[model samples]
Target: MVEVERLFFMGASQSSSSNSNGEVVFKTETPVQFSPTLVSQLADRQNASPVPTSERQSTLDDQIRAKIKDEVGKLRREEEAVQKQIHTALEKENLDRERDGAGELADGTDSGIGAVKSSAALMGDLEEIRGKIERFQVRKSLQDWPQVRESREKLVECYRSHKASSLECWKEVEGFKDSVRTLEKEYFKTLQ
Candidate 1:
């Protein structure tokens, strides 16, 4: 360790040390030490990298998830298209049947409304059936769609049997009747 002082020269050390017309001088030297733990930590973090397999698996999973989402969207679209076609076909069928029938103005209330005697019990039954189908409907395909078809037929029969005597009311309730068919179809489709 060597220090230089401007206030003192060679062989000059006393209460007032000086040099040739010297003033004062200061010396400062600081030593730095590297701790072992700190050095190890720095070396350990030299190359920061994630585990390769985990990263690779995450990438693979992302790709799979994207593919599945795309496939599900396509499937949903296809189902909707097929359903629309089926509904259109059903509508055409009903229209053809009506056209071929006798000259009926579609007013069942006149005489086709039948006896309104047990109408209360029948209405109660219909209401119960309606309760079984609120917000969700069962769906099925042609091969094993007997139950959905049965429910649909029964609903239509109920509508026809209890059709409003007034044409105006009948027209309005016809919307609800259409919903029944829709529910049946939707239910059957969901079942598949």
Candidate 2:
């Protein structure tokens, strides 16, 4: 004879049985149902309000502006630190060269080749650091301009436009960036 049974589990259940044929069976099940009352309760929960597109765009713009400002400030700080390092190096090199000169004079053997080479190397390093600072200053100046901000905004709009392809906006973006680069180069050249 075959036996049949019915069981109801609220959440989850695991059952094992041995049939008359000596075969073992295991079954696991989870009983879940969405009740109308639960649905009504869920519907009653307050949802987060959505920000308007214009407000969101303005917020994004503000964030971008702040980020650019932060980046520029950081670059300026780094440039200042590099300048300080260069100055410190120059001072230390001068002091060392003075000590070497004094020692050589006392020894009656003055081979100033080493000192000259070191001074030349130090000058090269200082020049490189000055170039970096000049470039950074030029970039910061470019970023500070209102026209650059307007161009950026236009580029952003072009990218965001539904009818425009991103590729189409690349020219404007590259043009503005190239202009900034050119300005930096010209400014650096003037320094030289």
Candidate 3:
């Protein structure tokens, strides 16, 4: 039989020993103790009051609003600075224009008038192009003329009738070609 004893750092002790009959016995000493300050601090923590949910929520809301106000103020200051810079640049440009005797730079109305003139010119150009396109669409092809159409039909009929002897259709072919040439000459004359 063997006997063993153990001691813990927190002031507790455990011992095991064999009795005369070979049975084991265990004994434990006193539990760990706490300093007075530590005990008082733990007691104080247990008794401390907690903030209510509504009060905590309101404090958080106030903090968020303060942050938003700070950010908006920063943005407004930046915007004002930018506006001042633009005004200064415009004033400098106007002074330069006055020195050059260019009439202190034209206002928005003058530029608007120029824009209207440009738009009117663009409309005129568009109208001219449309007229040209209409005229081209209206012009008749030589094949559509009455004399040319008649001769072409005759030539086609003659070729159909003289399938194996296409030479016999020479007269009709020559007549069709002559009609086309005449129409072409008239079209060119009209252009001149």
Candidate 4:
């Protein structure tokens, strides 16, 4: 007589037996309906190992760096676009002022207002013109522009250096964004 034990896996049975001679025999019985292709595929997958932690971390780091670079680039471009809009608005306002000043001067002179003006009044008029020019020259002040530009530059440099992750520069990036927002608000306020 033989003592036998059987184990089952995936619809297959494996058996081991000890015969009277004290020899061991092993037998495996696979289901007739089992597909060899499916078994081989599963076996291959089971045998394949997962990526090492260090390699996986490296890949994640690369992805994060790429994403950060993309975000920074997008922000920089947006900032540039806003700056251009601000410049365009300023130019248009300046041109309007010039045309209005020219028209006002022509109207005043043609209406004989300048012909009757006293020397003191002319001096006051000149002074007023100088004041207007000075105000126009420093219209928005741009006190925040340099700070925003510097912060953006710092963020870009940090990313390029690759010594630190994007998360580390997040505060600087946010600061730049805030500065730009403040500048934009100031610009719009001036327009108003």
State, as a TM-score between 0 and 1, how close model 2 is to the true structure: 0.29
Candidate 4 accuracy as TM-score: 0.30
List the candidates' TM-scores in order.
Answer: 0.29, 0.29, 0.31, 0.30
Q: Which regions of candidate 2 fall more than 4 Å away from where they truly are?
A: 1-52, 103-192
Task: Give the number of the best model, judged by lDDT.
Answer: 3
Question: What's the lDDT for residue 22 in model 2?
Answer: 89
lDDT of 3 by residue, 61-134 (tens): 99999999999999999999999999999998866654553222255233323242333565887899999999
Summarize candidate 1's per-residue lDDT along 19-135 as a digit string, tens digits.
587875443354678999998888787646544578898998999999999999999999999999999999888667554542433464333433333436559878887977752
TM match of model 3 to true structure? 0.31
**What does each candidate score in C-alpha RMSD?**
24.3, 27.3, 16.9, 24.9
Q: Looking at model 1, which ten-residue stretch has the lowest summed lDDT?
A: 108-117
Better of 1 and 3 by lDDT: 3
Backbone clash pairs for candidate 3 read none
RMSD of 1: 24.3
The local lDDT score (0 to 100) that residue 111 gets in candidate 1 is 38
Consecutive 10-residue window with the lowest summed lDDT within model 4: 1-10
